[model samples]
Target: MQDAPRTVTFGPKRFCFGRRTYVMGVLNVTRDSFSDGGRYLAFDRAVARAEEMVEEGADIIDVGAESARLEAEKLDPAAELERLLPVIEWIARHLEVAISVDTYKSVVAEAVLQAGAHIINDISGLHEDPEMAGVVARHGAGLVVMHLQGSARQPARQPRYDDVVAEVTAYLQASIQTARQAGVAPDRIMVDPGIGVGKLTEHNLALLRELPRLKALGHPILVGHSRTSVIGNLVDAPIGDRLEGTLGATAALVALGVDVVRVHDVRANVRAARVADAILRGWTPPWPWAFDAVTGEQRRPLRSLRELARQD
Candidate 1:
């Protein structure tokens, strides 16, 4: 485990690791997203969805114009900017939600940010673009840097790691160097371990289990395991049925003191986080959930949503 990073503020939200779990709701502005495809493809619908995520207790809204799922091609800068900027503008003008533009292209970032988005949730870190770090720095925007082990097109398979923890920690340290050297304030950057984008299941699990190891990098850790295939494989379920796995993963991260979780099922995750936060903060249980949601029967371990949402 590593020392926690300094507390940082993103717009009006302030987070210090070990305090509370921050939820980042996914608002895919695309027609082919793997999880919520076409759910928010229209600008008005996307804006409304962003508003609802805020109402659902999401602390941040992650807007993505391209689907980075398997074989998810990168969106060209112009089209991607065209798809995201309007929604960002509407969110910024209407809601107090802190919007995160999910793109690796500096061009798209520049345009959407100019429209008032507050953060850059780039999956490739700064490895994908020459000017991304500078753009973040110039705007003093928040940054989410992730570690990827392969090309843009392939999942990270059999990624070589003499020491996965040490290697990832060092890479993040170096990326922080790149960020600060490019004028990005050291306090404004957050790090994600690239949960599923390029990592295999073992790699993803290792990163999650050893997430405390990442705090040594001196930045908040962002865990995005919600509805990912890694959870599906673990529970033998499809994308829609991995809520329990998602809840378990978020609980584990909260136990490890991770700062944020990027998720799709915000309501369930909000419930789970409430319970986990109570346990971590030494608070009382919210509900005595010794039974199931629909039926009043004693459930098995980790079965009740309210039980899952209350202190153990």
Candidate 2:
């Protein structure tokens, strides 16, 4: 396994991996996303949701103007920019958190990055647009090169892979090479296995089970498996009912050393990730609470003898 850099820069922010998993709240500003479409299509609602995610402890707000759902119509760059730029601009001006724009079009990426997006999450894995790498490199913005076997508009009906892990690793490696060739810094790149893009349920399960191999590529790993079909297929739950399953999968991902989890339900996932981080990354008391050794309990301070002794 290659030793990846501990920190990756996104705009003015730097994310330190292995300390605690970062949460990337998903903000799909489109009319046709698989889930939560049209909910925040309005400009006001979109900005409101972005603020809510930041307040809910999201380290990055990923704004996508187009849907990657299979059979979903492709959104042109003009229309996509119309939906995206305003939201990106609003978040950049108002929020202190990093912004990642989810797109594969170089035109859209160029505009959004110019408008203040920190990262370009190319769901196409840098395969569709030849100029995408150049645009991201020029801005020196962070990049997420996701692995999708086929086009997002019409993904393979039955995708096949002999060794899913090895193939994904190879694909991501090539994508990373593309980014490097285009002058995108190694420290500015992340990789996603593209959970629901063109993967089968079993394929998704295998990828999740063997994520350490992907981490071996030496880039921060970002997984957007929240409320996806894999969770639904496994738990037999629909889109709105997959929160518990999503949290369960998130806890597992944290244990496996994922650097960032792109999720829809930021508040619940943030709460779940804190517990997972406490257990896996070694708990640090960021709060003003004392552990009572005798009772084996945590409590707020109220003139405790130990506190007075420490003060002295």
Candidate 3:
């Protein structure tokens, strides 16, 4: 793994990467998001769902006011702010996890940050609003800069790239530079390769295969592969039925040392990530006690057969 800062502190929390993959539960409060949209549109329902996710092992709660799906109508800044403020306030006051406002508008970003959101997840990579980097900098919030080949408002055309990994890395590098120039701290920035944003299936697959290469950029890598079309297309499954595929992809990414996995099925993904992390990083049992087969007593620490034979 490339050498980078292992921890990112935002607001009152510190995210320790490398020990295990962090799960960022998706909380889209819009009625038109790709999945799980209207389910949490009401403020109370949103807060309740957020609490549910936190209990399910979500390290962060990403609240989105507007759906990022291309066909969804663009939300005005006021409407976006209005939609997000209540949920943001509730999560901020009640939840102990880090809160991220998924928005590209500088006004919404500023408003949510002041309302206790700790991060701004911009799909435009700080390019949509010229003042976005400034807003993030002013609030000293963590920033998730995702790479998209085209504008989020329009349908994404099938993008072509001579070298997809290299191109994505270059774009993120420039975006990070833009953020730094605008005064956002480097350690507080994360890069997402934009899994389903503008890329074709092959492009998304290639990015997944070459994900470890992104570590060269010296920032934490956040991959949002939860229930996206890539998985559905591969398995010929619908969005609502792609949880297994999502868990599969999430496990693969965790094995590759991804710092964070943005997901919808928080509890399932958390279990999957823990297993994958254990396999990749090695795990110790939480409790040492184990039943001894010979004695029928829970008096010995769990040990492999090889260790027992050696003791004999």
- Which residue pairs collide, candidate 3? none
Clashing pairs in 2: none
Best by TM-score: 2
lDDT of 3 by residue, 96-213 (tens): 7899889989999999999999999999898789999999998889999999888867637768899999999999998899999999998899999999888899999999999888
* Candidates, ranked, lDDT: 2, 3, 1
Q: How well is each residue in 167-200 modelled by candidate 1, as lDDT tens digits?
A: 7777777778889999998778899888877666
lDDT per residue as tens, model 2, 1-312 = 223338766765667776778899999988888889889999999999998887777888999988888756688899999999999999999877889999989999999999999999999889999999999999999999999887756777889999998999999999999999999999889999999878899999999999998977888899999999999998998999999999999999888888899999998898788789788777454445466779968676555322232221
TM-score leaderboard ranking: 2, 3, 1
Among all candidates shown, the one with the greatest lDDT: 2
Candidate 1: segments with Cα more than 4 A from true spot: 1-6, 153-162, 283-312
- The whole-model lDDT of each prediction reads 0.80, 0.87, 0.86
Better of 1 and 2 by TM-score: 2
